[model samples]
Target chain A: MPHRRSAFFISDRTGITAESLGNTLLTQFDTLEFKRETIPFVDTVEKAQEVAARIMNSADSDQHRPLVFSSIVNPEVRAAIKVDGALCIDFFEAFIGQIEGELVQRASLTVGRAHGMINEEKYDSRIEAVNFSLTHDDGVKLKDLDEADVILVGVSRSGKTPTCLYLALQYGIRAANYPLTPEDLDSPTLPKMLLPFRHKLFGLTIDPVRLHNIRTERRPDSKYASMDNCRFEVNEAESMFRQHGVAFISTTHKSIEEIATNILHKANLKRRF
Target chain B: MPHRRSAFFISDRTGITAESLGNTLLTQFDTLEFKRETIPFVDTVEKAQEVAARIMNSADSDQHRPLVFSSIVNPEVRAAIKVDGALCIDFFEAFIGQIEGELVQRASLTVGRAHGMINEEKYDSRIEAVNFSLTHDDGVKLKDLDEADVILVGVSRSGKTPTCLYLALQYGIRAANYPLTPEDLDSPTLPKMLLPFRHKLFGLTIDPVRLHNIRTERRPDSKYASMDNCRFEVNEAESMFRQHGVAFISTTHKSIEEIATNILHKANLKRRF
Candidate 1:
């Protein structure tokens, strides 16, 4: 066991900003190893003190003090942690004063999604894309899909690539997908590309009516986004999946995360996140 | 802007696991429009309650207790959160006990890398690869390129892919990389592939001596991993970078996180966690 070093990301708001910024900093110290923990969205002195003690407990070298990278905005919370002798690196310490000064001058400032919030939104977008993709997955690249933990098959614009990437980036699952082309939909079977990996295959479906609206956004007045085509594909695709014993999900109203999780759960797979 | 339905991820071990798992679950409930945050590596009741309040504060409806999915290993922490009225779902609640129970009949089962402390060893590998790759990164990529958040140029085994992926995945930066072929090192200012992205480019160099040994592992007697060739390439690459005012890092003992951050910090760019 090498010498143990750890850092705590403590926050007054929700700890998301603290964690994101702190985690990013910790990632930089790859040369110097440190154990990391995030204690988020905490708002009180008692809570802060308790978190301080837990962090202190992790520091076998110091009984009375521990190093903490804190981003608590409240003055009192900061005071409480100080009593614990924590070496906190405040995220806003350098920015707040500058921002307040600017506020006095009334310079316009753009607040981003919460430090944690932005990543979540980006991830959510990917998830939304994935869920939407399941219905349209036609399984084109199933043969060379070494990296994908699972393969999503669906039709055009049914949302596969974004979900695959989401699974890859978020859960470290190598998820590759192929779109369902017209030929595959014209046939009564799942694409032959998926037959070799039937065990890992999953599908997504949607209300043709809803999908038509989504597709129309990208390629309006085209047959690809036409309502009749959307309905035919949805019905044919659902039957094809059923005939082939492939599991599918309706993405009509579900969010990507919901769709992905539901699929993961149904598949009896444990998420790596 | 939506009514914030709250979500939580708590853990007894490093909250990273909890967050990772929680993030996957939170991906579900797309229609619910929830507000979510993670409390990573949280191990105590005090910590759980601490995170619980953050969830409570963010909730929009009085009738709904925030949905919390956590993995605190300590029974005490889980119990504490339960008493506080946060709807908690976690790996501990879902699986730790099952793992313990299984230990009685079966050989101990192990999960993946989260259980390991290999950061230091991996960092060393990355750094060593960096120094070695410098022999390959020509000045072609380092000139006049200003739009790059960061450019990572290296060789076949120089750890460029992992490093680049880490930078983008962890930091949300659009990192583009091009390999330095041996041909570029002989007469190059830099590889032409990189010439267009010059100002944004950063070179990753590693100890040629270490790299030769690494290459030898993959191919026992290949000319590619030879010490003489590595040394010759290393000298030319470093000189090319210097001639073009390209600042570089010897990644002979750094982690992906560290290398990326150093590049970001050195470039005066803000890090995204």
Candidate 2:
């Protein structure tokens, strides 16, 4: 049996960077099972002390030393988190010195700038993309289809909506999705509304069994969730994409981030944020 | 003026971890402007060679050496990215060996597990949260408010929608948001629909000036976008939050991640994924 290790992702801001970096490294060691916790917004020394105490307590309770991934910027606060009984990987301390040396300049040592609210332009664009995605979701608003960075077309439960939302929320891409209904799937040609914007159209396809599983969770024991219907829709959608030369991805074994990033690369769309 | 530098975030998978970690580190050096690009899915030796060529070309064009932040796991592919004239910071190489030594196990050397599709439960939960946030947006579908992990309440354009969406997408939290309309803001008490869910309610406030800016972009010259209306709405919303003792954060200079993380900590909500 694999040993259970406590892992801490500590940051003065969102802690997302710490968490992502830590998770990326941890995946390399498949032999261990990790119990994870994220401690965000540890900007002050008092908060740092609390985080240290929490880490120490968890370390004491655990058989193995806790693994801590930290991205704290303030020297004072960063110093306070160097608790015993844990292997602390201070990402800022590990890399910032090298970066500063390479650039031949001193870092500002400011806290919260990495994920702070200071950049209004970037923030507005992200919010704008979010609004655009929400307004145009599920082909609700089709008049401004050309304005979308990418228009995802697929049958229901093919992972169009989540991929679109991920593109908007993560990369600030103005993504809109058009669900290919049963009628549309049966049609010999592409939908009329999508022809003009073919270059911006991307398609998503999924395995019939996986689609059935997803649809069953939403609406069980119905024709819409039936295996036959899922297979038919997926086959038709994939053929439609191939016939029209629209770039597409299979979402069966891919994460939303993977699908979105692959679509952006294949569609040659630049992320706004 | 500070020199401009070309920055590349390279990864074997989606490049999100590389980009995020790089962006966080680069924020400390505010003096330099970066011409940034993310090269995702560099899982093969040929792709690595192409990325290396691209980086070298950018380095040739740039006055300063390009900074490359990479999270490539494949040793063969990682070797191809060690291009001259670019300061490559290989995240995996820097820390993975130490982690392996600490764990006393060999790494899987897998290409795409960090943000991969292996975890179906976590992926499904994220999609569920996205669907939940969409259905319950702007106080819609309020009958099952108890199902929400966090309920965001704010006035129009106070950033309730994006924050809720972020909470859902990033943390897999079922976040529903209610916009505090003029009618709701005019009253001294909280909305009746939110009374039963007060424990899960998290308010969002923004500077009136910033709110005015955001509203003006959506509904230009309208009463809701006017400065006086913005001021009145913000003041009323904050006062109502205070009167109701609802936990709130100002969205003026904060990112959606910042706002969501703070709310999660304050509300004591657990992430589903």
Candidate 3:
């Protein structure tokens, strides 16, 4: 059996940065199984020492030194988290000096700046974008269509809502998603509401099998979930996108991050964050 | 004005990991301003060379070396991005070897695994959580209340909705947020509907000034957006949480990521992703 190991993502703030970097690194080692935990807001030396002791305990029980991915900015807190038995990978320590050298300046060593409410304007804009996306979701509100940075057009269950939400939350992009209903798909042209904003339209299509499965989970034994209907909807959506010179992508096997980034890239939308 | 250097986050997939790590690192240098660009989907040598040329052009235009933070897994593609005029900080190259040495195993050298749909079950749950949160948002659906991992209760505009969305999107936590209406806040006790789920209940409170400002933007000086009403709502809500023995956090100056992580840490909820 492969050895199961414990991994800790420790940081002074949300630990999101440590988790993202650490998870990406761990994904490269597919053979290893990891039980991961995030310990956030470890800004004080006392908290850091407590975390160090906890990591040491895990190492003792697992009989293997656990991997510690830390982004603690305080030198004192960083020093306290260096457990003897753990492979402590201090991200800030590893790169901050290099960055400082390159930038010809010293790091501020401020804690909680990465994911904190440091920029009120940016943060408020993100919240505003989320509200905008929510209100305009699934063609709910069309009056403010011109305000959207990008409008995603797709069939039901082709992964539009989640992608819009991700775009708004991750990038502060005002993304409004419009579902291509059966009536709209049956027509030979794009929806009349979307005509003026053709440049903002980005289509998402999915494999008929995947679309059918996704719809079945929501409403079983319905025409909406039927394979034939799913195929027709996707085909029509793609045809409309191509006919209108609109850029589109398949969301069949893609994560929301992938779909959102692809739309931003294709649409040339600036990410507010 | 501080030196406005160009920083590029390059990766094989969505470049989210690169952006997250690179953003955190850049935040440490408070004196420097970065014009950041994310170049995602650089999976091939040809694409890598293109990005390298782009970085070189940025360097030439800015009259300074651009900072490139790449998480490209392909060695050949990684090599292609090593432009002469830019400082390439390869995240994978810097840490993968160290991890391999510690684990005594080789990396898979796989591309597009970090943010791709690698785990269908995990990805499905995340999408499901997003749907669940949306349906249950703003006390919309009270049925299936027991299914929530954590139910957030707060006054309207106390940062519950965005925090719930972030929890669902980032951690796959089935977070349902309930707004404390004026009538509910008028009483000195917790809402009867939330009584049974007290253990699963988390509260969010914001400063009265912040709440008033947020509400005024929506309602434009209505009674609900008045400063006096905002203070009353927040005071009553906090009292109710205290009387009910529910854990709560202040979201006055917090980002959604910080608020969500704090709730998860306090609730001891395991993040699904």
Candidate 3 — which residues are off by over 4 angstroms?
none
When summed lDDT is taken over every stretch of 10 residues in candidate 1 chain B, the lowest stretch is B107-116
- Higher-lDDT candidate among 2 and 3? 3
Looking at model 2, the pairs that clash are: A117-B253
Instruction: Flag the better candidate by TM-score, 2 or 3.
Output: 3
DockQ score, prediction 2:
0.75
lDDT of 1 by residue, A41-99 (tens): 45688987897678767765633234466665566776677534455555445344442
Write model 2 residue lDDT over B88-116, tens digit each, in one string: 99888888887887788888988777656
TM-score (chain B only), all candidates: 0.51, 0.94, 0.97
lDDT, candidate 1, B1-273, per-residue tens: 443456665544334545543443343223445555555535556776776666666553534557666544355666776634455554444433332242222212222122212233333232223322222223334443353466777665565655554454444554555566788787858776666667877787878986786678668788888988778777777787788878888766554444665676566654432
By DockQ, the candidates rank as 2, 3, 1
C-alpha-based local distance difference test score of model 2: 0.88
* Residue B136, model 2, lDDT: 96
Per-residue lDDT for A176-248 in model 2, tens only? Answer: 9999999998785999999999988988999899999999998999999999999999999999999999888
Better of 1 and 3 by TM-score: 3
Which docking category, incorrect, acceptable, medium or high, applies to candidate 1? incorrect
TM-score of chain B of 1: 0.51
True contacts kept of 3: 0.69
Cα lDDT of model 3 by residue, A78-114, tens digit = 9999988989898888888888888999888777776
